[model samples]
Target: MALDDSMDRDPIHGSDDNSPDRQGRSTFVAGERTGEIGVTLSGLRPPSRSIVEISPANIARRRLANWGAIQGERVNVTRRETFEYGFQAPRHLLIAHERGEREDGETLIEGLPRSTLREFNCKLSFVPAGHKFFGWQTPRVLTRVTYFYIDLQDRLFDLESGGARPTIGPRLFFFDQAVWDTALKLKAEVGNSDPGSRQYAEALGVVLVHELIRLERATTATARLIRGGLPVWQQKRVIEFIEEHLTEDISLAALAELAGLSLYHFARAFTQSFGVPPHHYHMARRIGRARNLLQAPTLSVTQIGVQVGFRETSSFTRAFRRFTGLTPTEYRRHRGG
Candidate 1:
């Protein structure tokens, strides 16, 4: 399940004002806003339009990962707003609402409702590949959401059966903690300076896809869990690899390839062997490294945090506290003093 290197070479086709897509009647202007790379969707064709377009004013941040792109936005409507929009790309779309709610609003796709009444945070809506949607919403204070656009054509989850690939049905106002958490992680990488963020984003996309597939199966029957752990040699190799790239954003797909296992099987086997998830193991190792670095009085706490893969001092502090029940400052004051 190693990621295809070709994804890195694929040209990202985004709309521009000067050169608009012939099929679509809209133009986009790409630029960086407040350190976030984004595209402003504008120039709707029809004369009568009140569509809720995906614009920079609505989008807070955006990140283009390998298999898909993630966008974080806040939709604010002072007055009642109704709109109809459609996406042309043949890809799956996931929208997670973090905040806000509207009891009167209704969003429809292909003549179906997308928004739910009395549901606010963590609500999700999914649009399958190649589907066109039309939505309408009532006036609300503001709604914060994260959008995950997945290009299913990339064949990131190829199965050996050679049968039809699993497809996610359009769902509205559902709750999936796993998908929500992964989307948040992807959103966090929007303007990350870490060199491994891309790998991390790609890994999250793979996990999200697998989770969606599992969700699809849950409707009919329980998902069968894969048995057993990795071989001793494979376990050792993956452990060594993690240690070597402790500072980098290690992808689960890459690790699965090293073990010659599917992502699902590899994750199960990894947890079985190590008594923790791969991400937790990596974080533990990072904190261990941070502990070792704390002893060196010359390195500041922030420097130690960055060295151990935490981009923010607050995040490093929180992780350090969670792992050792002490912040970096407190740990250094007691242990490294």
Candidate 2:
């Protein structure tokens, strides 16, 4: 298959005026060929391009959104259609099947086969850079899928092996709740016009890439910590301080001081004992407090966000979604608030 020369150009910020259906949807001609389906993955390359055209029968609607070089799309498959196509790129590909009725299809990437995907079953596929992958599927029912494009050269993973890049093999139908959750958040950010949406999308992209690295390195032996963990009194003091100052700008330096250790050593020892970074633990505590505040009908979302240390509602929403996979309002609603 021939590559689209236009794809080499900067991504076009599509508008509803340019859409064939004029349904207020943005559209762009991602490539010249028709075989390539779905939206172009973002962040696979700097100044990424968007895949605007998709088979009308195969895709009912698609929304393309970008965060820096990372791009994503939410696709609604309308009909059952078989397609055979290949993708060649310098970036990695992540695909998550969000929704589907009949779980009776097959996909093959570089001759590796996987059975049909089921909803929320932790099934995802990863395609590495410099690879040509072929996929064929004929869904028996309508489906919703999301795709994330990532550039390996971004140095986001920090793999740094004497300038030798680590390579990830093709993964098919794997179970990873974290990756799935991050993809869902990315999908939720698609087509959002808020000013902070891009930053939220970028943060989610970083998280997704980190999860990818963790998944790839799962089999490797972890480095041993210099010491077991923070002393018992230090751990208790830190936890209490975090709870009391949940709304303050608690810095890593301050936490390290409280723990009476260097920044690097404190971080390592904290993770060794708590199974999460200090910042992560702090965020979890904040989110936990926010959840309780959200249950109170008297407090508005903004007020709750402020009470939980977030200055902006958007940032709070993004962080909350990252932890619980739901916005504050969504969580409250589900909890019968």
Candidate 3:
């Protein structure tokens, strides 16, 4: 199939260790990540997603690639702190936030208004080829996400004409029971050593893509601007300011001024656009940045906390624990630093 042709040239071989291959199922290697799709997947450029896609600093990953049709990665954030993923890809990508709740954060896709909806467990997000998607969060718990990469050159074909249409629009943290179930089945197959598990996993991948096609056809109605949210230009300006000031104490009045709205209206509209109060969102971004810093040991915990705007170590630790269920020290330990 052209799917294999679209993926990285490396082939997935059976694991030599006496664990999975003997079960008569095609193997899922637990070794180096340079398997079928890892190379090109990590090769995409600037504002590099290699850290997020290949080996996130504080994440422990278990990957499964079956027949080079689809690749699935089960990611466990070792700590409950901040984390993010982003970048464009050469192929279709789907993400399942298996278990996560973000106190503050947002999902930015190329064509859609950014999504700030929190509490996104069991939610699915799709990024079409060449579209940029990035998101971050100060997790409310240790997060688990299942990522799927499908190397599909022409993702969809209209049956009547049998010609491929565009795959699908970028989806940000949406729900579709059929698609979710199929994705979950693929993730479960990661641990399955049963006979035919390989074939079963690959079959599930096909079903999952088809389910997405059905969803796309069902929703071609059109996407309208969110009535109560900020206009795109105003939103872009406000978000740009907020992002640049993540480590500073930002005033709501200042943000409102930047949005050209009165304080009360700006607060409401900002919440409508971002799904959280501006201060909460700011704090979440700070905590999230702090987490990435924790992944490296050069900085002391206290210095790291101060850098994210907490003046006192205790305050930072308390806030970090409140959001992530772990202190900076404990999180660092989990990172093996």
Off by over 4 Å in 1: 1-52, 55-88, 111-118, 159-161, 222-337
Off by over 4 Å in 3: 1-56, 154-162, 221-337
> lDDT of model 3 at residue 254?
81
In model 3, what lDDT does residue 318 have?
A: 80
**TM per model?**
0.44, 0.45, 0.49
Per-residue lDDT tens digits for candidate 3, residues 1-337, read: 0101111211111122112223222211232113222322222233354223433554655555554667787887776665556667677788998897866544566787656566778889888877766655567787888888876653332323555544688887788899998998898887678899888887788788889988886665212223367888988998889788766767767887897765546666777888976666666777899999998899999999888888789878887887799999999999897
Top candidate (TM-score): 3
Better candidate number, 2 or 3, judged by lDDT? 3
Question: Which candidate should be chosen as best, given lDDT against the real structure?
Answer: 3
Q: What is the lDDT of residue 230 in candidate 1?
A: 66
Candidates in order have lDDT scores of 0.60, 0.65, 0.67
lDDT of 1 by residue, 52-153 (tens): 244332323333333234333333333334322334345667877777465333344433433335346677878776554433333354555666777655
Task: List the lowest-lDDT window of 10 residues for candidate 2.
Answer: 1-10
